[model samples]
Target: MTVTFSYRSRQTWADPWDDYRALRDEDPVHEVGDGQFWVLSRFDDVFAAARDTATYSSANGLTTAPDDMAGFDEKARPIVMMDPPDHTAMRRLVSRPMTPRQVAPVEDLVREFVTDKLDAVADAGEADIVEALFKPLPSFLVAHYLGVPTEDRVLFDRWTERIVQATAESAAQDGPNQQAFLELFEYAGGLIERRKADPGDDLVSGLVQQGEDVASAMWIVGFIFTMITGGNDTVTGMLSGSAVLLDRHRDQRRLLIDDPTAIPNAVEELLRLTSPVQNLARTVTRDVTLHGTTIPAGKKVLLLFASANRDEREFGPTAGQLDVKRRIERIVALGYGAHHCLGASVARLQCRVALEELLGRFPDYSVDESTARFAAGWSTRRYEYLPLTTN
Candidate 1:
């Protein structure tokens, strides 16, 4: 029997777990688009593909382009798409200030931000988590980390929204996506110039001090884009997803509330279950065979991290179930291998701090699923609006 699958369909985004489970069980390396590409659903295959950068290259791009943009070349697409030597060099340059030690100082700031946001919504009996908390918190943090002025933080949010919208089907032909990219590039360029004149103690300043060549400047801009966009989207989704998950699973919420120390473990479990980053696309560097399927060279392979995270084969029979107490060593939620999320530490820190504050302040809060809406047709699962009521 043959089954069909598509990552672009609205139904898939609405509820992807069912399709992912089917693919993992029946066709681990299922071909899609008439074998134009392959999707890997098994945990082992996804992990191996991520690590085996040699065979599965990111040089082409980290996402499968829409049919309209099929001819797009992303070889020079910054840190996410660069392969080996170049990728290593760029990643090292960007990782200096992002290390856990460097990012440690931001925890207090994150706490303060989370506290202020939650406090503002405290008086109100209800709030949209996306607008009121999850969205602003990460945008502010990303701005602070990137050295964007507080005054211009609003612009960052605007650009982020436009960019994110561009990923949706409705905005596929919209000009805002390109406009946002250009605007962001101009903003980063101006910031780089300022950093060059009077270096500050921030990530942008660090990049400026690195060098002032065309290539160096472009790389810096790309890094800035990656940090800002990647930081905001994934963190937002995870936080929103956590709220919804906990609201649904009061039992797990009780566990975390009773023992605040369990928040960290619960964060991992939430990441596994939510898996905000549903899938990432990689170019086939060479012909590779997996699960008796041969994917020819120069093809695109979609690594379904979301599926792998819930694979019963790897996470046991209860993989479909969310157990905050479940003891699991590691997960590919943040990704795996050479291109694992560079901001994983910061993201985890933000999520942990946000969850702690959220649970402490609104222990009895509940989400109104009827009022909830999720973004569609993109690699990341994010909330456009998530309404909640607090007692």
Candidate 2:
């Protein structure tokens, strides 16, 4: 049986497990658009391809859409679209501040932020957690790092929404939201210039001082774009989606409430189970054969991180089920290999702190399923609104 799947399909966005399972079992190397691209659904296959950066290049772009889809100039290249040495150097420029040790000092700050959010809704007993808590916390944190003033922080959310809309389609045939891309691009450049004259302890200031090259400035703008969109949405989705998951899986919720220490492992498990950034596209550098299929050179391949996270071969028979205590040896939820998420340590820290405060304060919290609404995007899972009751 042949299984048809496209990242843009609404059915794929709503529920893709059955199709993922079919593709994994019957056709691990599934092709779409004849020779346009391929989807790797198995854990091993996806991991291997991610590790072999030379064979599966990222130079073309991560999304299946054309390189120019986002309306950036030909010279504009985000770190996500580069490979190896250049990618390494670009990532290193800002990687220090995001490392686990560096972000550790900010735990108190994060907890304070989380505590304040929970306090606002503590008495109400009911609130849209997505809008009230999960959404704003990450936006605030990202803004804090980027040195964007509180008044201008709302722009990040607005910019992120438009970017998501641009890539919501399979091809982005009409081209990406040009206005949003240009608005964000120009905003980042302005911010960098400001930081250069008046250096601060923020990430942007640190980056500006590190370089004076035209290319570096271009990459910085692109990197900021990546951070605003990927950084904000990934954490928001994890928290909002996990809230719904824990509500459905009371047993797991109980485990967390009973032992707060279990929240860290539970965060990893939740990420593996509910991967927010479902799949990322990579262009094949040369012909590569997996199973019985021969994917020719210069084609695109999507590493199905969400599907691979649930592979039975890697996680055993209960792969599809949620296990708060499940020991995850290796999961591609935040991606794998050379392109692993640079802000991963920071993301984990926020999710861990947020869940700790949330479950500790409202152990019996429940999600109001009827009012829950998810954003219309297939690339990354996002919640428009999620109502919750501290029952």
lDDT of 1 at 245: 90
Please identify model 1 stretches exceeding 4 Å from their true place: 8-12, 66-76, 168-173, 213-215
For 1-391, candidate 2 gives per-residue lDDT tens digits of: 6688876443335577888899899989998887778999999999998899999888887777655336655455787888998888777777888888899998998999899989988979989998788877777778778888667777866776667556554333344467777777788888888888888998888878877673467766776776777787788888888888899999989999899999999999999987988888888988999998999898889889889999999999999998999989999999888888888888899889988998889989988877677776767876768889988
After TM-score superposition, the amount by which residue 375's alpha carbon in candidate 2 deviates from its true location, in angstroms, is 1.0
TM-scores, each model vs. reference: 0.94, 0.93
Residue-wise lDDT of candidate 1 within 149-237, one digit each (tens)? 87898898898777656654446356777888789889888998998998887788887887755236776777777776688778888
Candidate 1 TM-score over all chains jointly: 0.94
Write down the lDDT that model 1 would get: 0.83
Which ten residues in a row are the worst by lDDT in model 2?
A: 167-176
lDDT of each: 0.83, 0.82
* Model 1: per-residue Cα lDDT at residue 193: 92
